[model samples]
Target: MTQPIPPQKIIVHQLGRDYKSATRIVDDILQDPKPGQIRLRNHFAGVNGLFDAMAMQGAIGYIPLTPPFDLGVEAVGLIDAVGEGVKMSVGDAVATTGLGGAYRHYQIIEAAKAYKIPTATPDYLAIVPTGISALVALEQVAMLQAGETVVITAAAGGLGHIWVQLAVNMGCRVIGIAGSDAKCEFVTSLGAERCINYKTNSVADVLGEHYKDAIDVAVDTVGGSIFDALIDNIAPLGRLVVSGYASEIVEGAKPVLAPRIYERLYWKGASVRGFMNALLSEHHRDAATRLFDMMHAGDLHISLDPTVFKGLQALPDAAHHMMSGQNIGKTVLDLRDGV
Candidate 1:
């Protein structure tokens, strides 16, 4: 008979407001899978700066959980054990993405909630939650059409980069906005017709000069001033999808004067719609399948941040790095090598 594998677990514990103040490494043990559950030995966990920061501060308006919760959402791993009624075999690669389940070395999840990873690559780390948001927001929420002009803010970031590729593949003219010249170049290389360095160039001015009345769909991830600028330049009957407000999430959100928005949007017939993946949970599976297909066919590209935060102890630093605006792609934590 084969020797049974030993159980091991390590978690990043959040104690209070701020990732630094709240997060700590804790030793844990894996529990036996109940029926319909599968135990995962996690390999990689994707990090979301806004989500992590907001979660640490207890400011994620949509999620009601308080402090003392696990600190991650998405992870890719292999099945270490399977319980009764589970159809998957041991050693199957899978991904689990949701609230409070991903930051540890081992996780017990419902087999139904976990999606089998076609291949165990780092890119799927982004596809699980971030790429799903990008794909769904552009295809479903924005209703993007061919030959239209699409503007994506934070275009070199995790979600933004995928949006750029998808929009480009959809036959749309893409305009990407990034924080620096290098990031602008990165976005441009992703097939954006134009890349605006928000730090140096004025978004409204650039659009007004070249793309005036041309934007058909605008995806705004960084809100505040940029959101206002996109609205100012949007074409008539355009759709502006708001997936996140990183500016507000990190620095604090400021209220836009009603008159400022009214003047820009009233006659244009443009609409600003808020989007949260949680609200559109029903469509996640289909979107993930499509994204995976696109990725497999080389129609999509996934960029992982060069900096790898290994082990549960580095999660707090990874979160901070993401929020500091230095990471060019998806921030990930490697949990496979032991905590």
Candidate 2:
């Protein structure tokens, strides 16, 4: 009888202040799943720029980050093995998102946690957690409404592209904020009414000049001046959702010596809300189901970034590409070697 080959996975062998630098592609051999568990052979893993960086730095306050931690969250793969009492069969494809599960050749996790899908495609990896985040942040958190003016920062990125399309589909007038003209164009092609290039244009100036007092909702991941500008121009009763501060992931949140946030909110009855996906468990399934349907029905699209980073060895470069603010779409890691 032939013996099974061991799997390889990535780990945070050390804590570095930066994510692209802290990672190590070490050899990993996961044990067989226990009863009610399934062993997955991951094919594609989503590159979460901000969270990856934060997790490496041990900056996510709620989650304790120790060395030798598994370093990915969202992945799509096929079941390589299944334990007793597991409902999913071997060779069934699934997509999963959770701490310490992805970024590996194979993962043994509870069968219930691995959501079954048609196949292990990059599209599933693009949508599972990232698309779920965008959907929940816009619909559940921001209460996105039709005919409203919606603003999305990092608008050409994974979540932002989905946000733009979802808002547009809901009949909202969507405005995207990105780092470059090409990215702006990309967002506009996705049905955004306009996209502000933050690199060449002033976010505050553009919003102030053309969109002042009209932004009904804003989804921002890039904090700092962009956040201040969104605050400065929010309409009365507008809602701004902060999903993640990509700008401040490595650099800690800077204490701004400006007028109190309430000063801006009190007069307008506006609100700034923070969002963490783990904190909002109630909406995950609904959001995930709806988004998957949307994509399948052609109402939503997944724009995978052109750059291909394959295997555990390429994860660090993938992280750098995403956090560099240069990637035009979802940066995906193909797990099949040389794929």
TM-score of each: 0.93, 0.95
Backbone clash total for model 2 is: 0
Please write out the lDDT profile of model 1 over residues 42-92, one tens digit for every residue.
888887767877677777788776656776789999998999999998999
Which whole-number lDDT from 0 to 100 does residue 172 have in model 1? 93
Model 1 lDDT, residue 135, Cα: 82
Residue 164 C-alpha lDDT in model 1: 95
What lDDT does each candidate get? 0.83, 0.87
Can you tell me which runs of candidate 1 are displaced by over 4 Å? 1-15, 257-260
Clashes of each: 1, 0
Task: State the displacement of the C-alpha of residue 331, model 1, in Å, after optimal TM-score superposition.
Answer: 1.3
